[model samples]
Target: MSGSPAARASNATDHDAEQLRALGYSSNFDRSMSLWENFSLGFTYLSPVVGVYTLFGLCLAAGGPPMFWSYLLIGLGQLLVCLVFGEVVSQFPISGGVYPWARRLVGKRWAWMVGWVYAWALCATIAGVAIGAGPYLAAMLGFAPSSNANIYIALVLILLSTGLNLVGTKLLARVAMFGFLCELVGAILVGGYLLIFERHQQFSVLFDTFDININGSYLPAFLAASLAGLFQYYGFEACGDVAEETPNPGKRIPKAMRMTIYIGGAAAMFACLALILAVPDMAKVIAGEDTDPVSTILANAFGPVGSRLVMAVVMVSFISCVLSLQAAASRLLFAYARDEMIVGSSLLKRLSANQVPSIALIVSGVVPALIVCLGLFMADAVATIVGFAAIGIYVAFQLIVIGALIARAKGWRPSGQYTLGAWGLLVNIAALAYGLGAIVNMVWPRMPDAAWYINYSMILTTVVVMGAGLLYMLLAKPYDKGTAPAGDAWELSRSGSHATGRATSQGFQQAQ
Candidate 1:
């Protein structure tokens, strides 16, 4: 603590590494990312432009103007979840996010299931975010936006993002920061223009449902439309996913997580509000006649050339989102493989000269590409695909929340730079309740007249993914092979030292 400023910073990094070692891991990642870069990663993953633009048409059709409120509702709920994650990551500060936190908080088996669900969810999210960019690219290029064309474009984006991700962690952080700036500034400029010069509706219009109702009541459709918000609010957890790569992660990552929710949520709501107020034909959108309301609104607000310029910015945001998602997924794979929990552990755990998970990145891109190919057989199912991704993540999140609750019940108190203290239990409980309710709202079958798979896509996909993981875990017993410490055993030895801001080799060995 009594060194030059540079040496002090180096000592802090050493302390971060020591904390990881105490948790039974030596630092494998580069650990060069700053707090800003880490937050950029989370912000880009939460990409407001990507979320609002992709879901605006669907939400408008399903719940009319009132659907805009979903952003506020879900933002508040996810804030609670983010708080719980902040405390978890601050204490554990490991890579693989929810999985490691669950492992440390509960047991190896429970963490394996969380990792299994989280990995697939991230892959699905990669496909969904990449595919969502296709139509925008098509429109900007003046190409006929057919299923084949969109598929081709989506594949191109996936490959492009994957290549960028494999280059290096520094490049990834730079691109994410650039994308965050571009997307946020573009959203503000475009949304501000629409609100100032192209407003076509009153503020009161948000409360008007335009007579949209389900079963003689509007509550059901409102709940269904909440998917718009639910999808937009996540990706904050990506901050913790790369905890190993960020210096002082136990302190920095939590602040980055909160900033992500605050800035990302506000930007999403601002863009959504401006678009809703500027909609040239709300009735047309709500009636399902205007399938591409976002394009229509932008074209009406800005001329064709200007709209194309804006679409280009949107493309960057989408690619950045894909890049972040791919990085996160590959890290989870690397974490799993490092613990010898997955099938191709030797390969997936290997790091390149750049300290990047090159092979894991390739697998991450491949899985999402496979999911994108499904677009050919099932057209216009982007919403369904993204819905499943949301549910998978939410379910995994709740697993961590439950694990933390159980750990608390057994006398586990967080002793990190970030802790909730007396509010920890209450916040964790609220997060669990909100997560459960959101899962129900998202997984409920709303398309009864459609094909059964289409109607129950989220539920079916979740069950299949989880069911497969369970079968494999039972048959293979991967949890038994894990040699790392788990179930908060480190706390019993190091909790006092952690509170005193001292992590010694003795504490690390004792925890082991």
Candidate 2:
């Protein structure tokens, strides 16, 4: 096989040695994360938020008792997209993840558009996740009177996570593993308690009733609710962004993604079910004074002390989610920088001694921190950010699945160990259908109320952001075509290139 276009370009460079040194191509990032670490990263990536359950309640509020079925339906829809992602990651396990795959499958211009949008979405998501960490932490510490302090706490959390990522991927993986374990134990313990003590509530209520009186159609309401539930499944792609740092990335990246989805999805499903069952009355629970469902459930199950303990667990889970998001967002920034797609390519390409993208990490963290502060001025700030982040993620997913289909149609078979086989076509179709449906639901007008107005603001904000991306593409079209060398070994390996002085070997043999 021929070498990557970037490698060929590098070979023809007048300053070849200097270019290689600057790009950190000579340094190795072949660290092996254990299966446990992989699983933990995935789990923590979907941490428990009061808002997550509250969003489900909103779904229940909007779609009635059939919300549980909506969760399952959305889960199935996401599974199809996950399969598409699984195929791509297995075939091209590079740090750029969807960006590079889109490029190869659809050409550089379209890839640039997708990468730019994904990078922005990632940054926005980091801010949204960071903002989420604050309320949970404040709730745990009984800091209700000083709700404003949550922003300060969020800043601190962002800085701490940024520091951890700067230390190295190995350390990040270790932290993720610890967080994941805590989430698992906490989920199981809480879930088991709910199952044993709270089974008196009719399970049939969670699945049967559909009495919401929204102005929208039931299908649209279900889609809206599903989008909210679907947000819980957003972080599995984090594994793909860090593919370059993993051992045997082509194989392990895909495995990690698949397991992340299955394990995390299953855990979330159980947690949601337990929360539903624990509620004394669905209508009363929806109208309850307590805004935080997990705390409320625990307070009922084991009194105030138990509620505080659950709050503490939730705080840790939020921190873990923020950390994972920070790490993943920085990787996306790094990839965009390496490809000259972002504004400051030179700064983003700088790596620390530990091979971490230090500059990118700081900038990515800081930018979102600033954006999240906007929440201080708006009542529904958190909801708006969540909605915007969700839209950004869905757009990226659409681009990736479309790219995968195009690649498959052109006979671009992946030689990796984890192939998606004949299911790829079906998966792409289902994912596209789900994605389009969710987008429509999110933008549909709701009943004239405070919540509807808030939803409208979020929808408008998302539309503006997307429009801005389109504008950026138009103005930046000329610059987007300037190709830079793919900056890491995983990318080079995918393109059939070896580092200088490395022997020419097929597949993963060179690294091994």
lDDT by residue for model 1 over 92-169, one digit each (tens)? 888889888898889999999999999989988998888778789987887768778777888999999989999988
Worst 10 residues of 2 by lDDT: 499-508
RMSD of each: 3.1, 6.5
Give the C-alpha miss distance for residue 257 in model 2, angstroms.
0.9
lDDT of 2 by residue, 1-512 (tens): 25785654333232223223433433244355665676567667766442354365566555555666755676677777777787766655557677766765666666776776777777777776666666666666766734357667878888888888889888988899888877878888888899898654677867654455445456655655665566777677888877666655555667777787677777777777787778765665455444455556676797867777887877778778878888777877777777777788789877888988899899878987876677677646655665677777778888888776666666555445566666667777888888787666656666556566664775677667768877887887633545643313234435654332122113234223
What lDDT would candidate 1 get against the real structure?
0.87
Report the error of model 2 at residue 443, Å.
2.7
Indicate the residue-level lDDT of 392 in model 2. 76
